[model samples]
Target: MKNLFLLLLFVGYSQAASACDCLMTPVRQHIKSTPYLLKGKVIAVLDDKNKEGRDYHLFLRSIGIQDTVSRGYSVKIIVQQDFKGKYKAGKIIEIHSTYSNCDMLFSAGETYILFLHKAQGNLFPTYCSYSNILDGSPASIDLVQAIRTELKSRD
Candidate 1:
């Protein structure tokens, strides 16, 4: 009986951990599917009192493709109601996620390569999108290059 209980507990924990598992799609696909893609830093993170989520204002640093984006644009992201993370101002991060799979996780003062989607004139990040931290990894570098290539091709 004890062994069976332990096995069940382990299985439950495994399932919970894999709940947010997502398969990484190609960079081109991500760019083509979304309306906007850029690299920016978090200027402020505010609580949406009307809704059960948080809104993030990102300072647009560099855009992948030159569209109608400005230098300082606000990318409003709404996460789960229970989200309690602290996003300080002046933190460099990326925004590239959809709103289907899960909410994107971010930490202050960290740089990331984000893929962004537009809905109702608001940009959002999800866990199912292509994103990477600028941790000096070859994969991260490749992703950035791929985004630049895609943007150039569109032009």
Candidate 2:
């Protein structure tokens, strides 16, 4: 009986750990699917409590918790370069993101590549997408180059 209990406990823990698993999309595919893909620096981070307060609630089902624990954050970014979007350079835009495990937490003064989706007149990014901080690393450079190549091909 004890062995069976231990096995069940392990299984439950495994499920919880795998709750936020993300299958990152390839750059080419992400470019095609994402509505706004821009590289910019975050200028401000504020609570999303304006007209569209609490965009959505993420429910984690692993631990059987049925409460909406995460709130949305609005990140203001200054467009330095427009990779694939209507926003021109030097324009400031606000993107709504959640603090859930499967979402992004933006910080002020950090540069990031945003793979945004338009929903209800708001732009947001999912944790499973190719959006991430641009830290001048090889992975960041590779992604930017891939986006550039794909955009040129489309043109």
Candidate 3:
């Protein structure tokens, strides 16, 4: 009986630990699927009341995405109002995900590549998206180029 109980406990813990199993898709595919994608630094993070009267952390000027159809126009990416954490200003982080287990996580002053999607007129990043810290890898470079290419093609 003791052994069985121990086994069950271990199994439960393992499952909980592995809850966020993300199957990463190719960067190009992510670009094609998401409406907004860009790279920028977080300018500010504020604690404020959301529209629903609920308390949430607002990432101010979180990141800037340029309008594909309009030159010299940019869209400011504000993290969804449900996010709960402290994000320091001037941190460069990538956002890729759809509000699932893979939500936004940032370290101050770190550069990242982000993948953003449009949902109900708001942009969100999830853990499942192909976003990561900028490690100067060829794959990261390729992703940046791909995003640039796709944006240009839309013009």
Q: What TM-score, over all chains together, does every model reach?
A: 0.53, 0.73, 0.47
Question: Which segments of model 2 are wrong by more than 4 Å?
Answer: 1-19, 48-71
Better of 2 and 3 by lDDT: 2
Question: Which candidate ranks first by TM-score, i.e. highest?
Answer: 2
Better of 1 and 2 by lDDT: 2
Report the number of the highest-lDDT candidate. Answer: 2
lDDT of 1 by residue, 1-155 (tens): 99999988876875465355778787677778765455544444434222322322221111112222222223333221111123333334334333222555455444555655555554566357775556778987887777777777877
Assess each prediction's global lDDT (C-alpha) against the native: 0.48, 0.77, 0.47
Q: What C-alpha lDDT does candidate 3 achieve relative to the native structure?
A: 0.47
Better of 1 and 2 by TM-score: 2
lDDT of 3 by residue, 1-155 (tens): 99999988876875465356777787567766764454554433222234211122112112222112211111233332111133334333333222222345544444555665555554455447766655679987876677667666766
lDDT of 3 at 23: 79
**Candidate 3, which segments miss by more than 4 Å at Cα?**
1-19, 46-100, 149-155
In candidate 2, position 5 carries an lDDT of 100
